[model samples]
Target: MRVLFILILLANLGVYALGQGWLGMRPEDEGRDTRRFTQELNPGAVTLTPRPAP
Candidate 1:
């Protein structure tokens, strides 16, 4: 039982490291256009309005 628990723990750690991008760039982020974020027009002009209460 202890061996199984240790194996599971290591697997979880490996997944966590991959998700955190500790190894390298994440696969999902490849070929993504990052310039759009910097090219926003009047980004500060957007405002969040509170919804009316029922």
Candidate 2:
């Protein structure tokens, strides 16, 4: 039981160090997928109705 606790603690410490850049983990550059879907979207056809005074 004590060994499991120590292992978990060490794992958490390693993750914290990696997150804080202490372990020299660099950020990865991801490529964006610029493929557009063929769906028709009428964004300029919005009609806003005014509400009556309460």
Candidate 3:
């Protein structure tokens, strides 16, 4: 039972790691993504400029 549990736990961990790492987002795509998706899904929307850092 313990071995089975460990195997299942390892498998779950592997899947979680794969998803968190492989499926993770690219840091470079953040800003453009919002505007890109917004315009694609909704027309006639004005895009706001990035806020200046405080």
Candidate 4:
């Protein structure tokens, strides 16, 4: 049971480190425009909003 708890703790810590970009992992480059044209969402174009709430 103690070993299982330690493994879980280590796994959680690793995930947190990776998510926060720690432990020699390079931080994300913010200068790059990563947006793709194909992924654009146009809900206004497809669905018309009713003037009154239904």
Which candidate number would show the highest lDDT if scored against the true structure? 1
Q: Is candidate 2 or candidate 4 better by lDDT?
A: 4
lDDT tens digits, residue span 1-54, model 4: 999999999999998887686875435744545565457686567866679977
Model 2, residue pairs in steric clash: none
| Per-residue error (Å), model 3, residue 4 | 0.0
TM-score of each: 0.54, 0.47, 0.42, 0.44
| Cα RMSD for predicted model 4 | 7.2
Worst 10 residues of 1 by lDDT: 21-30
Better of 2 and 3 by TM-score: 2
Candidate 4 wrong stretches, greater than 4 Å: 24-54
Q: Sorted on lDDT, highest at the top, how do the candidates line up?
A: 1, 4, 2, 3
Q: Which stretches of candidate 1 lie over 4 Å from their true place?
A: 33-54
TM-score of 1: 0.54
lDDT of 2 by residue, 1-54 (tens): 999999999999988887776877424312533243454478679879899999
C-alpha lDDT (0 to 100) for residue 11 of candidate 2 = 99
In model 4, the number of clashes is 0
- How far off is model 2, as Cα RMSD? 8.1
Tell me how candidate 4 scores on lDDT: 0.74
Ranking by TM-score: 1, 2, 4, 3
> Which residue pairs in model 4 clash with each other?
none
